[model samples]
Target: MSAQFELPRDGVTRIMAAPPRLNLRRAASYQNDKGPLSSTSSRFNFNHLVFSPPPSPGLPPPLVTRPRKLSNAPRPSRVFRFVFWVASLVAFLYVASLFARRFVGHVPSVMSWAIESQDEYEMVGQDELPDFPTPIAVTDVHGRSKWTVSIPPTHTFPLSVQEYADMCAQCHEVAVHVRELHGESTSKQQARASYYYRDPYFVDVGEAESHGLLPGFSKTSKATGRSLAKPLIGESWDYMVEKPACKTSLTFVLESADGGLGTTLMLLWMAYGLAQKEGRAFFIDDTRWAYGRYTEMFQPPPPADCVPPPRHEMLPCPHGARHLVVSAGTARDTFGPAFTAQFEDVRQDSIERERPLFNLARVGYEALFRINKDDRPYVMERIEELKLKTTHGTNGDAANSTIIGVHVRHGDVHPVEYQYNGAYIPLTIYKERIQQAAVAQHNRAMPESVEPAPAPLVVLASDDPRVFESEEFSGVIRAQERIKLAGKVPVVQPVLDKSVMHPFKEEAVGWEGGFFRVMFWNLGRPSIASKQTQISLAPEATKLRAFIGRAYVMDLAVLGATSDVMVCTISAMGCRLLAVMMGWEKAMVKEQWVNIDGDYSWVAL
Candidate 1:
């Protein structure tokens, strides 16, 4: 037996005899009133409750309660899920398609679309095109299309100075007639006649005199007799002073043999110098021979007529007045003392050289042909008009901005008779030279400031279109990194079209690759005396010539507007003419030469 003791009711201590060990199988078989511990088990108990025991000291505390289970919400059906996934996929595809359509497909820009639409509409016209006829296909000597030339419809020549004035008069007359017949206002008449031609501003003689632009007169004529003259406003006749005694007229006769445009311009300059020195009105007569023919090609201004009564129909030498007949060979000596008192002789026969005239050591070239301040406005206006009429593409920015002009002579120069025969300059040389010039010009034009300098624009005038195909030329257009220009440089050139009339193979025999062939088409047979023969061209030749001339003039204007740095080929007379027009110093103009090996180098002209 085992001893047993009982304590008071509040606390108990008991000893009892040890019972037999309970059967392990029977203990395991015991079950609680509640079923197995599961999510459905209740926390409340019917009998006395038992608490959990403490965890062992070395182990983590045991959990007091089982974890709450997540709610069994019903899952979506398979069909619904499939439909939802398909709809999501379709939405994603639709969005991707829209994005691709907006940005990835063959979508054209608004400008491009508009241009294309315009071109299509133009092609849909039924009647034959005006000004430009069907291109006359011609085969070259090699029977290849590459060298083939196309002749376009003929056009009329440019209006001469007299012809232009007459046309203006006719327009005014027509407008007046229309107004009288229809009782229209003067403004309406002007509007109706506006398309015919532009009337240049009349230069005021008084203003010219105030600016010291009028020529001076040192001597008087010997004739002292009365003469009959027409009334100022009407056709009535009146008696006037006979053969006014004043050395007020100077006439310059350009030689027929001087065919080059540059030579002609030099002669004009010489005549201008003499007139300015002697204070005499000047006249240029280029209407007789070779130079005359060339002169006729352009529509130059008429002789200045500012004299009072007894006005001669054409500019004429004063009666009984000593004449100064100067040739190209004696120009230097003749003009040397022209501005000084040493040139007192009334009659001086001076000759000039075949080259451009330069001033003596004292007078600078700029001072020699310096344009009067009054003439600047006219020149600028003329240039603006020419640019608007001639430039094919958008050259608005270039016309107003800093531009470096490059004149390349490669067409007629290929002929042995040409001054620069066998001289072919590679495109790289031009590119390098242009780059250097651009850099220099930029540096000179840039102000000492923190802002980056504006890159200069390049205007390329060349006889051959192949120059554009060169890596160097294209690189400039694309503004490649390899070019050493301080800033990106852009290049502009005239676009030549096939519809325009061009010279035939026979007409361009010597100058097969020249701009003349593209600009003028010879329609008649070659004359015996090539120099004396008049160039008979297709009706369209005149229009083309005028267009090309205007374009060339605009190019020069652009160059002149630059920062006084010009890079040009030595053989390119056009470039020299532009330099002279711009009043550029000899040091400012750079001449490029081509060696026998087709290499290019530069020197001051």
Candidate 2:
């Protein structure tokens, strides 16, 4: 059976999901699962101290020749001096309390992202650094938003099956089987005419619906649709999907080039949260997305039946816009700098400071993200296999081991995705934290018992394939053979184009599907990883990117749903989602979240 994590609507939700509830005592929810009972939590997040001063001594009367000359200026008396000293101490303590978490409070061991020193220097203009992306683009009040258009959630006019079929007659998929592209040999004919990656938006609504002539789809035959893909949750939605009267809708246009699946998901969640709070509609536009159809991987945004106002009626800025269209490019301008600073003045304690953002993030999780239809079964299979592989008891009969979810990201991220540095957390640091967690768990467990400590199983995910191959994680790493995902991360394979990567190409020797092989057609390709969307619309690259996207979602879902604890670098968007998925109680309160890069904080607009 597939892992069932359906969040209960109407004042209900399950664990590992929106019930991302507020607290927990143990790491894993399962009782039979045993490896650790307690983890290192901020049990004492901040100190609460009370101070008292000793009684002031009475001024000696006449013993001193104190009144010889009364100065016009008031002399410092014992009471005044004592009050001044007390005031200074209070001010000092106030400042100390602000940074107590980073200093006085117990902090999990932190590791650097192995960032290069040059990255620390502030960002230069786009023209100044032509080869790299700007670290973070500050929005301009007068500038036009990149997402100037908005496409309705429901097709503005339902695209009929016959019309779509007739329209897409030319340049249709020849069906040589895209999975064959992963094969070692590509025949000459296959190269000339075969399916590798379909053109963007090739799989239209009509092609995917495959059904009856009603308002909603009804399947009469066992025929599969044009696209083989499906979201982990809902495969199809109904006509007039949302309330007709809805006038305000938040459309998240994909800035497909900016970041990978993780970033897109995070931003979408943020949009969802904002829409809910503002009572606005929300939708996603993947027309220009490098990965092709949004529905190919996940469910469309919840119903907003009304079609969006014309592009002219839409506004880039959020303040006065009737219909809002935002992309990564327009986020800062839309939200403005004030939104980012909201949590800045909040408590520095990890949980409290993060509460405001976490609330919104959790709402996003509960409102939208769900286990898609395709990956549902695999989520459980992966978890069961991982637990079996890392059974913690000495007899090897223990139901499950305390687990740590680790996401290691080192794919070429410098100026674009991550601003802090072009650094990556080392596996050594991850290993140390896992060991530290296990030790802390033991201390919280029955310490008098002579049982040897059990090592927690590690469910690892990383962009670099080399990380999966590391012998350093052999003892803890358990899950085997995942979707090979990589792109510009200290790769060893000597390939032609260094910009984009295909893992299957490296694994399959003598394959000519290298990047530059399509050089003439790859014209105007951006050298930086972030801006490659210009030429990445190609079938091969997009398909590979989709597969890479699958790899990421799988890792995130499995680990988020099942892991006892998450030890990942919070710098990555997926890491934040993993925490959201693990439920706040377990991840935040019980201290199941162990950030290796730094303290816990979410990325803001």
Candidate 3:
């Protein structure tokens, strides 16, 4: 622990600068000069004395020695020649320096001296000026002075968008920051600013004269057919920055003493409104803020003392010009026991039976709805007038009665399927109603001598089975006659063809359903309610529609399933009825039919 350590040796040595040596002065003789007089000596004299006396201070210095002229060696004296050469070189250097001072005056030393001694240098025009400065005279296009008022030190007159954005930040931030502060409403605010409502005429100056709406803008084109407004009126400023339209109409107006005061306030208010959300300030008079001078054009003066026409004048009625009657029955007779098998379950209570029986009634009503909504009675007056035979008839015993017609469109409208089960089915119901009405009229015309029953019903099938399926349609005809005969009547049916199809189209086009066409028709009161008219004696042809809970029930059966049970359960039915009533469909229905076993054995009314 106490051991001494030895220091290692280094080969490097420190060097020191030597002091300057002083040279000894020696005397010089002109006769015994060596090589040349020492350059330190001023001169050497050879007139007398062994060593030349130090040159007298008062005596003039020897003239720079002249070059020697010798026969053997005509050479100049080394000292004399050196002195002469030195004098010549010094004079040449002095002349060179004078030339350099004149030519290279921009050298740093000269430049610094020039700056320090500025008074010594003369300045030409503009050379001593500070910088470019604001102009003295300034005015805007309106010939209003822009320089009248001092511009505030902090306020820039025409700020760039970026600068304006920063300036706007004092009131509210721009873009995302604005969005975050204001939330969803930010976009709406931005849209308002971006779509600031300049006159639409101004936006589309080319169409201004043609529009004839703005008299002022139109006047701009009065001098020539071409509108001068197009060159002057432009698009909005907001549209210019973020998204630009074809052109910008923004203008800088010079404020006049009288006019600009109101305009200035309005502009400030507009700018303020653009920034804030909830806050409000003074009302702006936009007229004062108009950007340009405009005169009203040749506007046609309005007609004097105009009077309006009366409301609710009578419109022409198409069908017979008569008040048409449409009626539907719930049950004309419950019928005799011969038709008792047609009844639903007897064990069910009246309330339960009422539902199904009423549904059955609705099926007939549904058919009637189709005819009324779609067919025009006037167009079908001839068809309604044509009578068919009724009852088991011999030649003379035959009774003639008018044919009531019914028609339906099932998916005939193509892409907009007028389906039989939905709103579209009302057209069918109306058709059926007209058919019933015609039958009722015939029965009312029945002679009192013979017992009267409901008028006979006739349905004109528009499409030939050939139009859809020739073979199937042929079979449909055979089946349809049975339907006609079952009710104890012969149908005066039209042959299905283009002409028959025209009636269907006419009926649809002529009848427009609304409160007027579908109004309730008054029939004498039933004896059950009031004995004035016996329900029993009432025209068997009179018709009625069934409604429950204020809504028409759509088809009771689902597609491919024939029995007339509701397609949806009672609860779902309620929901669907609501949906349909809310205009999901024009109409809906609940079908009624004889459910034999599980099969729906049904006949269209």
Candidate 4:
């Protein structure tokens, strides 16, 4: 069917047509005139209605209105178009991000089965401390591992200082062949016999001063100084690889086994000391070390890429073995009066006992660790932030402020971990020592006049955070709480209480790794008393415990590198680490450090 109509304003002819239907029941189908519109709608009616309705003759003409404007687009389809553009934009951003990271010197983020990033497995390191520069958090240890480097026969290299001096005269090519390599000189790169060993046999207190064992007050104790260790740490990359390169190498490794975080650090420290003593290239094989990659957690060993010879040649005992491998398994066998300890001869003499080849180990540890630029500022920034929070008097101003570092041991540390027989010391002991040290520091900073001293700032770190709750620390910033100004002096904690540390309650048994375990295996089996009752985290607890380890690392750095007085128990290896890390001056020169437990001294591991 078809239809035509005339315009309302002008008379016009109109026509209509209808097709014949095969059956009457089909009836007449009709339609209306059409025009372009956003939405199309046609009337379906009987032809009879269109033919009969001329709209009542007398009725006022229906008011004409402009066609309703409409859209042809469907609601669902428009929504779909918007969604596609959004998805495309997101994909573009992701690709651009990948390129941007690489442009900034970052390698593509690696994915691994052993290590996968999970939201719940929070990052333990600070935003500034990348998981890079080596020492991964937690991974298995490599045992009986074969390496690619070839071993050298330098077994006779480290005999004695006299012999070593002669060897250096011949092998190292020093400018002047002095009879004693012990004469005073401030030049750090030059080899000094005292830099390597104190030689308990030939004891001379005055000559020891010339060895440059102490990084001068100019470097370690300067007012604007940022590090207490950088001056102590001296490494000659060229010296290690000059002519013969690695004359010898020390491999500090685990027997394809894991170790406790604290014990492993101490082991590496001892190994580095021995390596420096022998002028051996120090190499760390924390390959399967429980804490991730070696470089991930720490700066690489000096003479950075110097790989060790094959594992088969690495011997356990007899210190000067060409390739000495030191592990907890062989410490007793290897360190048998080799050095760094008071020999049986010194046991009777009080003076000898007091000075047990301290510089020997001091040389080693000083050469052991040096802080990086990224981490150098954590303590400094926090200290400045704290000083701003504090109200320092002129005598106790930040410029001359005595920054005190205190490490309190509790939780799983004290009695069980190291087999300590004495009861834990009173917190009051720390208070008294801190008070005493403050007065001493005040005296050191003040002139002979009678002016009030400035208040001291204390940096407190602990295995247990609850100690901060005691009355002695009331005005301090609690690890887990908001910082509030409460006292004249303020104590700052390494980490918030919960995001990282918690007092270790006696939990399920799971401590089955380390040299102790290797020894237990060698001595038949561990007795019931030897078994550990401490809590062992579940396999998935990696994310939970990682940050706490990082906080511990920062604590050591801040305490040893920045603080003026250190107060901690020497029984724990960690506390002893502070002794060595603080440089010999703190123990010898001014004696600013304090070992709260009167029973223990800064005994070398």
Candidate 5:
């Protein structure tokens, strides 16, 4: 018997055989065991685990994602957002309006346009435009409507003492009001009153005529006793009425070696007086030597009624008329014999020793020099333009600031070698003068109890650039510093570039081969490379003239717009002209000074 085998399942016994023959039932059972398991819950096992197959080499890796958290913050309200936006818009508009107002304030209106429309808007004549307050309807003593006319500022000449005092009160409140409050105790007020009396404005027209304070006036003449209201010779009304006929012509030549703008103006006024007295058409011949450089810088309005002679015409007089050639520097007796003879006759019998002829010329000069209405607009425009051009920076604050004009004239004035060299003024002298002037001006502008005025900016004008190159320029700066140390605000001097000197070129040539060339060539030696006086050949005179002429005009315009005192060389014609234009006559220094002649005393015209 073969070895017996026991089965533990149910106590079954089986004999081990070499191999049980292959049965179909056994093969079927083996195949069933390899089949897939059921996915239903009934066949699932909780503890059983299964493994997944590896991924293919070419595939992408699996993606992992993070969970997000939800926010609970509250959003802004609609009303709050709307209110915020409205506030921002209002702020933007307010800022914009401020800028608009500033722009409107800065831009000057076109005065020409306003003047042109005067006829349409109002039925007033140019002469009827009120300078001072006047009634709408003017009447005589009888209460009947007389002609309604306005007296212009220019017509204030020959004003009475009372009228002058009234005008002074209007123009200068501090001078008049302060003195009146103090019972006129200040010496300054007395000095100013004396000056006012001497001014042409305060002269009594009737008294002046009776005293024979005019040319061609005989003391015994019946006309001298006429009423003051009636028009008189040398007056504007008389000048207008007695102008020469169109056919008659007269020429006046002004000849002088050292006469500048002031002297030339005085001479021109004398010529005008003679022309009016003789009833002859007048013209000025300045071709030989003239202030052409200054005159040409501005395009002054043409004379209202007269056609002046052409600039290029050397002979302005009519073909047959005799020319009256007068040397401005000649003795009074020989200056104009025909006119002088009448004064001599009056002087012989006059009780007052004062020279009436001199007073007549002075009065005429003031009248002729009054700026005309037509020229006013041009002057305003030029002043604005120059104020912009001369000042630095884009904001243009300097243009509006108070300007203290300092004009130092040097070069070719007189005594080039020694005693009176124009450029010989010491820096210390200029500093002291400027400081004193500034202080006086400050005191005059404000009341005693009030704070001082804002410090004025100093504007330098000089014929010789060397005047500025001197230590005096820096000395002026130090003077400003001294003002600050004295508890006042400090001022700064403008930094002017050298290029401002040249703005035009001279082209015209005359008997003198161009006024600039002849005048400057005698000033100093010429330099070849610089093309300026003392720096070039005589042919370059045109360039030199252009440079100096433009600079001179620029200086005048700058000085004209200044608001405060002007410290200047007393003998300089430029200083006098500036004082007249800017109405700063009282501020000028009255120190003892000399001219080209070694005469210790000299007075500007």
Candidate 6:
């Protein structure tokens, strides 16, 4: 309907229309002005508030004031920035240091495994004490399944001309078999036959006068300006025999233990190293003791990637090849499958095994050439030949208690799912197997003893059921049981201290497949019993452990810092050997699942 309209007077205005009729009971609706301000205030009524009219002529515009500038405010200092940068750098380094440490720490263990996984598993060959003098620590045996104790010292004679000659004759005496090898060349065989004879196994009496081409010492005894002419028939040949509280320490004391002089020397060297330097490499005064000339003579030989053997052949390390990791296997493989297959049977044959004699005949020669790098070529060539021979397999005589082995079996390589899968075998089963082997060896007259067994075998596996169960997966027991069965062990015993288990837990989430490796320690012919144990780790842990195994690879020049990422701190020489061994293993080495960020990659030992 038409209505009257009125308008406001200010520049901003609005019109009003009057309605003819009103419905008091109905809700009222009103429209607002069609301006920007009105639209912006659509939800608010600008006219709703009543205010007193501005004073008479509008009070003077509210007093205005300029705000002060904030440019003069205090700021952080340069020193603070510098300190921050330094702290950041340190933190970065600290983290990197941790990463490096994690990488390098795995090396020794991996190296140990590699060495123990060879065909000689329990029987590391007899190192020539005279030709190769560096001491090495052999991993103690695990799983008390057999009894072949290391022999005791055979003699402790005074270091004298006659005593020396007699001692030398014992080791140098040639057997008919060795004589046959020499065949027609009496001169050549003379050297071979006399090699062990000219010097006594324990006394250096003959060495002072007979060995050729070595440094000479002109000693003026402190008491007299003359040479120390007479042989002192005292204990400990290097030093004058000393009588402690009870008895005189003998000259040329015979080392009577599992490792003999080699181990003792290494321990001494290590102890000396630790005592002298915080982070320095191991060293010794070569000029002071019997090892002086030996170190100079046994320096490592040059690197040699020998020609591959014919399809059917195999070879092993020469007697003194340094940085060596020997394996016995078939032509198609790099480790001994035949030896592994015989593990079970060896126990059966041990019943009538003969006792072995302990000998340190090689010690003097080892001391003579210990670090001399010149003999390396011949040593390497011989080593290559040995490797090839071992690959082709050896006859029954090769089987002896002195030969201890660990069989690392790779899992079946079919069906991708199975490849990632792990099996569990109870520790009891392994123990039983060891017991059975011991029984068999005893039955065979191999000198087995009936002692209540202690832990002797260390089993390493990629898929350990125990670890999987910890992740809270369902039915872990079933999985663990399955693995135990596959492992061929029935008793479920944990070898490591329980405290170390959680932190060192090994799992197999990424183990592509499982493979078998064996480590051997030959204790002079048939003296095989020493400490033994088996450890099983899952795939991820296996890689770490395998890195430790890499140390046994003997070619240092070839083995550099390829595994720099795998380790944080290790002696430079140790690093080199680790790298070389990893290189030797090639594809068999484990993949690095753990890493720093996503950039760096891990290489072979």
- The estimated TM-scores of all candidates read 0.37, 0.51, 0.16, 0.47, 0.37, 0.18
The C-alpha stretches of model 3 lying farther than 4 A from their native spots are 1-403, 410-605
Clashes of each: 17, 11, 35, 25, 3, 163
lDDT of residue 451 for candidate 6? 45
Best by lDDT: 2
Runs in model 2 lying further than 4 Å from the true structure: 1-243, 341-350, 387-400, 414-423, 445-450, 475-482, 486-536, 599-605
Off by over 4 Å in 6: 1-213, 217-351, 354-408, 411-510, 515-605
All models, RMSD in angstroms: 36.3, 41.1, 34.3, 29.8, 36.2, 32.4
lDDT per residue (tens digit) for residues 380-478 in model 1: 664454344323324333332334556666654442324436656566766677667655555555546454334445556555555655566662221
Pairwise lDDT winner, candidates 1 and 4: 4
Clashes of 2: 11
Task: Put the candidates in TM-score order, highest first.
Answer: 2, 4, 1, 5, 6, 3
lDDT of 4 by residue, 259-303 (tens): 235556666676676567567777655433444444444566556
Candidate 6, residues 1-605, lDDT tens digits: the string is: 87655555766667553332332221112222244345556555543243222222333535423333336654568678888999999999978855653443211101011123212222233322122111111211221111111111121211222222222222222222233433536565555432113211111211211221111131333223112222221112233443222110111212212211222232232222221222211122222122112223344212112211111010111111111111111111211232223222334343111100001111222222232344345435534433343344343223222111111122331111232234423334333444454344334443364543222211122222243333322211120111131223355656776566356442323322332122112211122333443233234543333232221222221112111112211112222222223332331233211121123232211
Question: Where does candidate 5 have its weakest 10-residue lDDT segment?
Answer: 478-487
lDDT of all predictions: 0.38, 0.50, 0.25, 0.47, 0.39, 0.25
Better of 3 and 4 by lDDT: 4
TM-score for predicted model 2 compared with the true structure:
0.51
Pairs that collide in candidate 5 are 527-534, 527-535, 527-536
Which of the two candidates, 1 or 4, achieves a greater TM-score against the reference?
A: 4
User: Candidate 5's residue-wise lDDT over 71-152, tens digit each?
Assistant: 4654568678988999999999978855653443211110110122312212232322354321122222222221211223
lDDT of 3: 0.25
